[model samples]
Target: MFLNNLFSKIFRNQNRIEYTTGKAVPLEEIYLSELEKYPIWIYALEEEDVEGQDEFWVKPITNSTNVEAELSTPYILLKIKENNCPVSALLDIENMKLDDLQYWDYKYGNWEELNKLDMPSPIHLISIPSILGKPAVEFSVDIKPKNQTTAIARTLMGPDECKDMYKTLPPNICPVCHTPLKREINPNFIVSNKRSCLRYTYDSFCIVTEDFKNFCTLNHYPNLEFKEFPKSPGNYYFTPLNIFPLDPIRQKIKFEECCSSCGGFKGAYGSSPGFKSKNFTLPSNDFIYRSDIEFGSEEKKSPLIMVGLETEIKMKKFGLKGIYFDDIYE
Candidate 1:
């Protein structure tokens, strides 16, 4: 059966690869209002390791990197540093909405009738990928309400509330340089799952298994296993769940390649377009660590599940690696 299916699949168009799951919602069904509230910004601090010049690092974070690739949606760059200040003119706009949303909350200070904006709005992480594309450590943000029917907000009424809408994180320091954490920081909303099972409720690990099973069953692959990887909080990206976990290790091997900045949990290794390496290596040490620790524990509070790796032997009759974001749409 697998061989028959594989041969028939050869003729399928790779343009849009269909998933085991059904199609996602229609474009019109989602709007800016339906997306997460705050935009998710990606801050990247980088040094080119050029010859001769003393290595100068951007303290905290700075806008010096270049954009590589973007997923989820796209937005524009608005160079304004003003956070809480009211956006008075249309030119004050920075980013635009790319996907649809269910609802949104907006707040604007003063100029009550003219400056106010609100509603169940769609949002976007506007300057994220572009900022990531720079040479300096840039602060990328996505401001929702990218698309609105009116400028005067109907949701989140009142002065203090309006001020809250523009609130920033790590307050008072330039989010990039510790000058001030401005209201301009990316805004986001929380998505909660109430399922009680460790595998279903607490962790998104099942996603890995489902993807693996689909590929193995359809492609007749072999020796496939899921491995855990690190998660990047700022990017809101987690490693695939449903992989094996290494037993805690004592007297673990240490390395000299540590970040000059924050040590321990805060240290850095290497980074790719979407992920940053953890300071320490996984005990499994195997290029691929495989495990399946289900979620469900009441102890978990973080929204992101630990990342994991997926591996299959070269001899495996079937199976594939690296699920593409575009695959979801296909």
Candidate 2:
């Protein structure tokens, strides 16, 4: 974060060029009539994969998510051409809310649709680091972790392991994207390995902490069932008995190729930042829950793992690992 500033080369009646001078520059130093700089995170800016590189690319990071930037600094400003004019918006972390993003695609630019108003631009989303507040009431004031890291670990039920769950895609699958027009989980998931103790998984597969499970039990976290997986005590797996439909959008998530099934998608893409969707809906803040909407890929998919803010605060005392709560955009 304490690095050298960045500067952009200015060209008149031509395109604006940006470059770094081995130092970070103030947001004001790179002012332009045609462009505006926004704050974003430095965590993985250089490594992030924005699907439509041929059509659009990320704007220069004039304002990285250093300690001095916005409270939610983990973000990136994406630049795309709309009506032959440069336009951009912030792709925030965690909360995947693309409030003002436009004309997003997973493949090459679709110039014909640039002028279409209210067309939601697909972009990356992540949760920013946040400070926990006082709990409404403690879930278990007595329970605490010896060390956060050792207590929790991430888990993924990859392709081979999850294949039998859906041996074949439903017949009504989208012919273009190959997404099942109507699909559902196998419902029978056995938690095989239980030795992990506390698992905290994220991304398309929303695995949560088993420690938080214990903590939430006292406070009445519903639909949470921890059984023998890997044999010792607790693990993460999708259980239909515990799922409910809370993910807001009714449309299918896509990476590219405008299919009748998906909103906009082409190939394997990262999770959409649905925080900015006009029809965004969130699970109630009353309980730590799971979304009926499944995330991840056809090879391997998982549920939209979710936790309520209030419940998150209550879990704080347990000193849980690998868990953070981003405000759900309603």
Candidate 3:
């Protein structure tokens, strides 16, 4: 009943954190590093006795399905323990077939592995999705400890012992810190002008505010590219490999005044503004000066380009990094 009581108190509860625009600094301002890795989510369950006593009789319910196929994704069933004996932990029956039995004794590290066990005792039914993206139906089961010795022997000593235990990967991570990203769905509006804060969620867990920002990618040079200057007048640098002068190493330690065609020093020995230019102009004039410039026009019959650009024009004006595309049209 404690599980039922705790579940009723916390489920569907929402927490909020407020951040102001402009008042808050960019994530890059705090951390200069980029987000190079993906993040993951974690879930755990509790094992205990029926009356919230130390004696455990609850057996973890393990189930699987193979109605359409020979095997299905596995789901763990949790139960309380009492006197080193096992009590029932059953799930509701449905269109799917359930099999396989594995007992995990937190009291002991080794799990009692069974190939195929009998159907579980049904209690309450829940429709949860399988890891393989299939529909899953589960039944809750009560437990009865098999022994009187270790059932009272316990390790997880707090109310936090009960929880679902599983893990999965989320797509993004904090550009600064590499912690798993969480979601805040339709959270309270912290900033008066904004309707929602940027957040990510998995199941009932979330990464909010500071945690939310950590999951976003820091794009320093998302649109960066290098072009070639003619080695000799009339000769063109076409392929990526053919353009050796454009290489990172060769591009460094440069002489400014050289023939645009021959790329040799004959005129001035000083660096020219035109020697190398950054934030190059794309072929499309309409997309000029946009940090998040789109590549082709819809009427022009070319591939459409989309990239993450700053929402504010001031950021774009200050040369903020963002996504861009080039025209592939003749």
* Best-performing candidate as measured by TM-score: 2
- For model 2 the local lDDT of residue 27 reads 22
What lDDT would each prediction earn against the true structure?
Answer: 0.22, 0.33, 0.22
Write one digit per residue (lDDT tens) for candidate 2, span 1-330. 011112111111221123221222222122222132333422223322432111111234343322222222222233342223332233232343333332222232211122233334432222122212211111101112222222111111221121243345534455656544443433443332322223322222223346645666678766765433343244444342454343344233453445455653334333333232344343454455544455544433445455555555454445443233333333
Better of 1 and 3 by lDDT: 1
Per-residue C-alpha lDDT of model 3 across residues 103-153, encoded as one tens digit per residue: 432332222322112234432333332323444334344333333221111
Where's the lowest-lDDT run of ten residues in candidate 1? 153-162
lDDT of 3 at 68: 18
Worst window of 10 by summed lDDT in candidate 3:
34-43
Q: lDDT score, residue 219, model 2?
A: 81
lDDT order of candidates, best first?
2, 1, 3
Please say which candidate is ahead in lDDT: 2 or 3. Answer: 2
Off by over 4 Å in 3: 1-97, 112-136, 142-330
